[model samples]
Target: MRARNLAVVLATIHRSGPHTRASLAERTGLTKTTVSSLVADLLEAGAVTESGAVRAGERGRPGVAVSLSGHRVAALGLEINIDYLAACVVDLTRTVRLRRIIPADNRNSDPAAILESLRALAKETTAEAAAAGLRVIGAALAVPGLVEGGMLRSAPHLGWRDVRVSDLVDMPFEVDNEANLAALGELWFGPRESDFLYVSGEIGIGAGLVVQGGVFKGTYGLAGELGHVVVVPDGPGCRCGGRGCLEVYAGQDALLGDLGSVRELVSRLESGDQAALEACRRAGHALGVALTSAVHLLDPGTIVLGGIFAPLFPWLAAPVSGGLGTRLAQMRGAPPDLVVSATGSDAAVLGAAGLVIQQIIAEPAKLLGL
Candidate 1:
């Protein structure tokens, strides 16, 4: 009961910003005495701090403002993309303290070697976080594949199947799909929307469904396989053994391969290259078709284009919107709001950190344990 009250007070302050003891009591429905006790405990634990006093009115004395401390508890976020390995440390205030990304092609590479590299990176990140006076309570890995029971079921891009991530990382950690984590990151740290479809456009296309602030993983933890959705029944073959999958048209390789490199492609697009514009248009249309299916089935409130899609949103938005507007115009007042991710490509990594922060929020005693 005491631990629960402590969490309530902390979460209240976290959500509402600086709050006085009396205000916290009113918000939490706890007595002022209990709120004071909990706030004291949090202050001692370094989980929260007291700011300067806030004047209530002309009659009453100023009350001390209490807010979450940014220097203490932290979580380590890790990501393993086909082209890069990234790590970030985020505090309770959602401030990123340290981040590092290394370019590496993990596709067809030995899993053991990849794990060793990640371990080294994790060790370095943890040390740096500790030096910053932050305790990393937990770690999470965002993989570009299907994760079930802490094991990667399959990553067509990485060519990894049935690999146990726990065996690879010695520390206590949680594993999840990169797209799912990116959705959670956006939910927890970005717009704070309750329902949305987060599409990740990387080397492959994937999506994560956020329903009421929770990721809706299907029964097999493969709920949002947007990349595999068949947009063209008899189109080009996909790496996933499917014809005309969304990834075939919109994925990084498909869109950028013919142009030589991402830099060259972006330069050409800026220069009004007809081919580049045409490619983006086609990719946007494919994305719209897949997203239309998503909307019809789930009817989410918003659609977030994340990962590499964010950078290309300027060129992709019009086509995507045109397709969705034409298809869904019959049913609703307006098509769902399509927005680029605020975190850009960093969403997955930050979302991995959010996994740790979520556990601590759910059980404040975990902070005591740390």
Candidate 2:
């Protein structure tokens, strides 16, 4: 392996614990000499510095302590959903620093609008970071669509198909399905990014899945279309040419069908309006029904709730719990518990930011100037 690449591997081990050169070599499957060479490179690069000397209780020379430089890189994330767009700045650790959102109109079949918006938002986030003395290196955009090979497959609500985002957005930006980014955030924050499914309920519904730490994107980019999983064979027509799709009942518009807006609907539900309560229960039931199939197939450890509908989640908790309760009862145990995302709108944006960081880590060769 290249010494520079191996140097990163060594630094990672060092940050993880007090590892010896032998242990680093063993962990990375590199020769002792290779590890030593790489460690020397790291020392020279200033990406790693000896913290002090560790005195092992033995005859060996005192071990040198090392730590990562962690250059304080900042990233930006943007979430483009059905009716709104969210932007946020995050650190390499996926912590959101600040965020903003605006109403999005997906008309004219023009992805250009989104491109312009992303550039402006990214610039704004960079300026904000600079003012705060932060250095931003990359950005990630999350969209409610199937993303494949730098292209958007088709977002039924966004009314865009086969669009190339790489050509549209500016430098150091990567785009992916919004749910996937949510899953990333959840994975890092959840008990762990284990075999789990993430359900994001907003103006539209989408899913992100992680079987292990890695995301499982099916043959096409639209593998985990859990939201579109039919809850009822003939419940209602969905824009995606399906009947009883969960989105028709649990999506943002579903909660706002006859209301002023989703925010007001949340308030009504909060007040326990019998009508609003019923609607929330129905939405929950539909969500549970769709989830039943996924739970059966994936058997995820947990399900995460996010987006506009998160606050109304408590209203639907009973139905969701009941649905999962009855299903899991067949296997003899309590139902899987649900988690409301504390990240809210910022989650998706930060998820997008995580994408860029993940990319740079996965392919360091693409990373310039250390």
Q: Model 1, 43: alpha-carbon shift in Å? A: 1.8
Model 1 lDDT at residue 1 = 91
Lowest-sum lDDT 10-residue window in model 1: 361-370
**TM-score of each model, paired residue for residue:** 0.94, 0.84
Question: lDDT per residue, candidate 2, 211-271, as tens digits?
Answer: 7676788877777777788988978788778898998888877777789677788788778
Which residue pairs come into collision in candidate 2?
A: none
> Could you tell me the lDDT of residue 344 within candidate 1?
89
The deviation in Å at residue 307 for candidate 1 is 1.0
Estimate the lDDT of model 1: 0.88
